[model samples]
Target chain A: MTITLQEVLPTYFEESRRHQSEIWGKQLTFNKGEYIKIVAPSGSGKSSLTHFLYGLRNEYNGKLLYNGQDLHGYSVEDFARYRKDHVSIVFQDLRLFPEQSVRDNLELKRQLNPYHGPEKITEMAERLGIGSKLSVKSRICSYGEQQRVAIIRALLQPFDFLLLDEPFSHLDDNNSKKAMELMLEEAAARGAGILFADLERIDFFPWQRLYHL
Target chain B: MALSFQPIKPLLQTGTNAASRWFSYIGLGIGVLLLLCSIQMYINIQQLLGGDSPRKDGHDFISISKTITDETMGQLEKNLFTEADIKDLEGKPFVSGVSPLLANNFRFQLSGGSLVPFVTDFFVESLDDTFIDTVPPTFHWQEGDEVVPIIIASDFLEIYNVFAPSYGLPQISESTATNLGLQLICYYPDGNRATFRGRVVALSDRINSIIVPKTFLNWANQRFATTKELRASRLYVKTKDANSPDFLNYLTEKHYKVNKDKTKFGRVKQVLQGIFSGLGIFGLLVVILALMLFSFYLQLMIARSKDNLQLLLMLGYSPNWLSTNVARRFIPVYILVVLFAVAATQLMQWAFHHFAMYDREELTTWLHWSVFATAGFLIALSLFTNYRMVKRLLYRMA
Candidate 1:
């Protein structure tokens, strides 16, 4: 499966901002099982592209196609099916139910489309060094701990592509490297691709092509 | 990964007032009870009145006559019913039999035993045998018969008993009156006199008249030849449904008068039924108001959890699944409330049958099938309404 962006420009951007951006008017495609990096400056719609690909934001000028069908036209049931099986996303805001524990947050998504057993939640938590914090509420957790929790919540499902918007923003270098290794290993096991958008280049991630936004 | 509503449950229940919802449940319970009780009371009243068993000893006989207004008062013949008028009444759907009341045309006087000698001028009439409540074998007369058997109205007998002492006369029992012999004298236009022996045979609750055999009255009217002719002024109408609104309204429209006592009681029954139906409608209004109140709580809950719901949707939680779970939470509650109403109705009916009605065969202790059908209808209605509301609220948030 491949996602194609056709001369896409956000509705909120100024005309001068569109001319200076490389991805605003260009047609680009990202294939399955391939790692692609987009280096976007501040206020450059890096999060907007992630939201648009996840079928969340529609305030854009041009079409986004997933497997040749317009992503904007996907019905609710179609989105549920594709989001369960085709694509997954982790927002930069780390949208976790604050009152719920780490185990509950992971179980919620896994229950929707279960590709793993109940034990996989504990296994993934332990591997990310948050297994002892499983019973703790996500709200009281530190920023770095919440970001890792969100990463596991997104990876609990089967997908052809995972959209990460500055996933390592709150993590230190060592933790960021650990979380990145887990994401890439999980992505490689299922032949799924990763579209990682961040403000700067990370030397650890092996990318096939780098687009400047 | 068990299917659990644990995560979304707390999110949905926030910001909702519990007391308001409890008040709604009470209102809903009262509404359902009123509706069911109204139906049961209707059936109970129907049993008490003539609605349950249509026949009482015999068919219902309604006495009808044209209203005697001032313009037609002195004109006796004009006020009497014509044959066409009788035919029109007989053709009505509610009427099964019609008999014109025949009266003795000649002047008549009856004198009973000589002790107090109950003597007075009296009028004699005859109606069809079918409409009479009680008919003895001896209540028959033929041409040239010296003995005449009569049927007297029981109400008239009671009235005479009440007033008999004032006139220095004795009050007679029903059996005594039946045995007492009497003299019936008739005078022709030329003042020639003829006499016959009269005896009472039966007392009737059906008609209020001094009833003789049709053969005797017709023959006497022809022999006496006192006035121009004898015209029937009233009729005995046999009907299946004496309390039918259509039949009564028809009589009113045509200026036909019926016995006031029977219709007075019928009017009372109608008023009671109207009250029950009105109360039922009022209860339904309360139920609807409660449902709307509960919907406000639902809106508050969803509105409070609007961000959580949007995030859940963002995580690929289908709106259909979320709505189903939300509605499922309340469907059982509605069913239990309706069942509570049904149980209350059943208890009331049992008490009515056991205490008020003395365990009569007229009413059943349990609820009627129609009551359960109403309960079922209410459940389905609540289900549809809840499902629709949840769907609309979720879709709006989306």
Candidate 2:
């Protein structure tokens, strides 16, 4: 499964902004099993790009294609099937059910399209240092803990591509390294690609292909 | 309760206005109860009409005659039933058969012998044997039979018995009267007369005229002077229901008269059936209104959870799958409500049969199979409509 972007630009962005943007109005292809980095400044539509790629928004110029099929033409069932089996995403804002327990949040994802067992969730939580917070409600947990929870939730489903919109922003370097290591192991096991969009480059990880915006 | 649906359960639930749920269940219960009751009552009415009327004669036989008014007095020709009139009356849907009474146009007399010496003027008529309550096999006759068979009205016998005691005459029993023979004398206007022996063959509680066999009447009328026209002054109509408004209305519209006492039961049955039919329609309306109310409740619940639903859809829950889960959640409640209504209808039927109707042999103590089938139909309709409504609402969000 490959995603192709043909001269894509967010419709909300001005023509002047597109001229200064490297990723906009450019034909790009992100293939399966490739770790790609998209680095851009603030107010450069980083989240908009993630939302467009996740199929949450479609109001943009040019085309966003999934395996050569235009995104605009995707039916509702097609989007759900792709989300469950082809792609998964970790939103920048960590959209978790705040009142639900951390364990329940992961259980929901696992049961939707189970690619992992409950023990796998427990094993991941232990490695991320949130094993003790599994019974706690997501809202009462700290922001960094919720971010790790969100990352684990996204990884619970089977996917050929994973979209992370600055997933490690709230984490310290050590926790970020553990989370990234776990994500890479999971992605490598399935031969899935990871698209990490962030503000700047991280020293610990080197990019296979980097898009500077 | 399937684990597959648990992922969207929290987001799709809204529990504040719980009164709507109760109201819908209650309304559905009442609506279904009324519907079933209406059907049972209709069935019961049919059973009563078809059972207890005691129509030993096997059909309602009504004799109809044109009402003679002051203007029609002494105008026998105008009052007689013409061929067109008979054809029109025969064409009525309620009239199963028409048998015109053929009256003797010449003079006839009956003279009793030494046992009960009495003489009376007679006007004999003949009807088709199918309409008579009692027809002996020997009632038919040819040209030269020594004796003719006659059937007198049972009312006429009773009237004679009432007057016989005052006249110092014998009050005869049915068997004694049937064995006696009398002389039937027919006189033509040309001053020639012929006599034949007549025997009592059968008695009729239905037809009022003294009836002889059709063969005998035709032979005697040929020998005696009579008009060529075979018009009927009175006709007996066979009907399915004597008191049906359609039949009675037809009689009234044609200015024909019938005995009202015989139709009193029919009037009561008609009024009862009408009431039950009205109740059935009202019950159907209530069922529709209740379903509509439940639909509104479902809409409100889905609307309250709008934001959460959208988020769940974004989480890869298909609208169809989610709507199916939501609709399935109410299946047990719907089943319970319909079953409760059916049980209630059965109880009402049992009570009506045992207590109100005093265990009438015709009525059953349980609800009809159609009532249960209707309950099943209601459950299916509720599920399907709720499924469609939920699917439509979720599709809008999608």
Candidate 3:
């Protein structure tokens, strides 16, 4: 699937802010099975960009096209289906249910499809170095561990595109590398694309294209 | 990715311990209690107004007589109800049947054998068999039958019990009175006398006079009366509704005297019916209010759990699925409440039957089938309403 953004400007940004930016009010397209990095400074609407693509926030100008169809035209149920079947996101805040155990959070995503199983969750958790923390409540886990859990949760579902809004901000280099390696392995196996957002570019993977905001 | 997770239990347990929900439960319990109590009380009052008589013939049969006055007493023939009067009463819209009470012209002497051999003259009045309340299977008597079935007024026993002790006579029980044998001798005007054994078959509160089978009375009157035709003094009018204003007005306009005791009973039944109807309306209002309160509580809970629900929705769970998870939590509570309410009502009914019921023999059970039907209706209504409310809230949130 291809997501095309035509002159997209968040409603929260002031008119002067849009004029000060190059990414806003510009036509851009993220294609399938392509690794792209959205590099931006702090307060440049990276999270807003990710939220718009994930169908979470709709208060933005411009027409977002998913495979040539207007994203605004999709009903709530249609958007839900699109999110479940095509787009997966690891939010900057890592919206994991605090009261649920880490395993439950992962299982909530994994159980949406028949191919993903508990063994896969365990394997991913072990690789992410939070295997032992899987049974602990997400509220009690460290921010880095919770971020790994959220990454594993997002990867559990089948998606055509993975949206990473500073997904490894709390993780150290090694943990971030491990998380990125696992994400690449899963995305490669499913022939999926990745949209990674960060303040600065890191030499984690060879990006086919990079955009600066 | 297979969505094989059983999120229902965990989701339900997450918000299961809301203390405010107890208010809804208590409200429901109170509503159910009021409804069940009203049902029970209505049934009890019905049994009470019906009295000890198992048959409901009293409502259909009205005893009417010509209004007695000094002028009519001086004119003896005017006191007796003519054939025209009977026809006029029978022509009324509410009147289904009309039967006149026939008095036996022959003199009958009743002697209690051996126990108390005091002889007394007794008058026998007979009406149509349809008007009699409790007719025994052996009430019919043939000419050759040795025993004659007699039904005595229940008030006669009450009066006898009141005065017999003062006169140093034994106050007999119903069974003893029924078993007591009496030798009946009929004295004809031509000096011919015939003897028959008499036994009390039943007791009647509706009929004021000593009653014999109409067939037996007809035969006895034919065999012993001096004249072929005898005018009736009292009439039994069967009406659809004894408490109808038109019937009462007609009775008043015609200057007919109705049995004050039975009419008072009819009035009491009407008043009791009104009371029960009012209680039923109140109970319904309480149940409706309780339902609204419960729905409001459910809405509040769903709102409180909005974040969890939205997270679930983001995970591809349909609003309907999440709504069902929320609704399932209340299913067990509702079932238990209904079960407990019905059980409590049944217990109350049991206590009423064993201790509170006046005529235990008349009503076999205190728990009427309507109670279960009403409970079932309530359960269905509450569950359906709750389910719908939960779904509506979830859909609105979606």
TM-score of chain A of each: 0.97, 0.97, 0.96
Ranking by lDDT: 2, 1, 3
TM-score of chain B of each: 0.75, 0.89, 0.56
Any runs in candidate 2 off by more than 4 Å, and if so which?
A4-30, A39-53, A57-75, A199-207, A211-213, B6-12, B52-59, B65-95, B111-116, B144-146, B177-194, B218-226, B241-256
Q: Between the candidate structures 1 and 2, which one is better when assessed by TM-score? A: 2
Looking at model 2, the pairs that clash are: none
Ranking by TM-score: 2, 1, 3
Residue pairs with clashing backbones, model 1: none
lDDT of model 1 at residue B105? 89
Error of 1 at B272 (Å): 1.8
Number of the predicted model whose lDDT against the real structure is largest: 2
DockQ of each: 0.45, 0.48, 0.34
lDDT of 1: 0.85
- The residue ranges of model 3 lying beyond 4 angstroms of the native Cα positions read A2-8, A13-31, A65-76, B1-19, B44-239, B243-261, B285-304, B358-366, B396-398
Better of 2 and 3 by DockQ: 2
Give me the displacement of residue B17 in model 1, in angstroms.
Answer: 2.0
Q: Return whichever of 1 and 3 wins on lDDT.
A: 1
Give each model a TM-score: 0.78, 0.86, 0.65
lDDT of 1 at A78: 74
Tens-digit lDDT track for model 2 on B1-398? 23476556776655787888789889888988899999998888777765222243566888888899899988987788988888998898988889999988788988876677888888899999998888888788888889999998888888889999897889989887777687888998786888889888888888898999999998888778567566688999888878676887788898887776777666777899889889988988888988999998889889888877777777787778889999998899999999998999999999999999999888889877888898999999999999999988888787
- For residues B1-398, could you state the per-residue lDDT of candidate 1 as single tens digits? 45677667876755538888888888889988999999889877766765521244555677888888988788977779898888898899988889999888888888876744777899999998877888999989998778999898888889988998998888999898888788888878789988889888999877889999999988888888666575889988888767766677888998988887666656667778889889889888988988888787777878878888888888888787888899889888899999999999999999999998889886778888889999999888877888889888886665
